[model samples]
Target: MPKEQLREAAEGLARQLERQHGVRSSWEGDCVRIKGAGVDGELSFAGGVVDVSVRLGLLASPFKGMLQAEVQRYLDEHVS
Candidate 1:
């Protein structure tokens, strides 16, 4: 996917996260910073590549796998 498209997809993901998990996000150039009760992360897109870094606090650690899956699903659905 191109950077623009990736950014759009990420924006969608951010909204979804906010609605579902009460997370909040903001953009800084090509990166989106995300935070919630037990999550903190940044999603960045550059040169048609997307990178996501998420840190789950102790209470959120157990949901790591689910978070990964949701992100993958979002990319799969929106990027292609």
Candidate 2:
């Protein structure tokens, strides 16, 4: 995808996260901080580059890798 298209898509996903999952996000540089999340995920968007990182606290280490997968599932379903 073109840079602008990717950015637009990233923005859409961010909005979807908020509207559909009740997740809050804070943008810093190209990264976002998702809060009130069982497994908080950081999504970076810049120049058509989007990256995902799901942070499960030390207490929930087992779920660290699951954040992105779960979010992808939600996006696929567009659950609203």
Best-fitting candidate, scored by TM-score:
1
State the displacement of the C-alpha of residue 79, model 1, in Å, after optimal TM-score superposition: 0.9
**What are the runs in model 1 whose C-alpha is more than 4 Å off?**
none
The TM-score of predicted model 1 comes to 0.92
Write down the TM-score of every candidate: 0.92, 0.57
lDDT of 1 by residue, 14-75 (tens): 99989988899999999999999999999988777788999999999999999999989988
- Candidate 2 stretches with Cα past 4 Å from truth are 57-70, 73-80
Error of 1 at 27 (Å): 0.3
Candidate lDDT values, in order: 0.91, 0.64
lDDT for 59 (candidate 2): 62
Per-residue lDDT over 1-80 for candidate 2, one digit per residue giving the tens place of the 0 to 100 score: 56555545556777776886677877786676776556477777565555677666676677555556766774455322
State how far residue 2 of model 1 sits from its true place (Å).
3.3
List CA RMSD, all candidates: 1.0, 4.7
Q: Number of backbone collisions per candidate, in order?
A: 0, 0
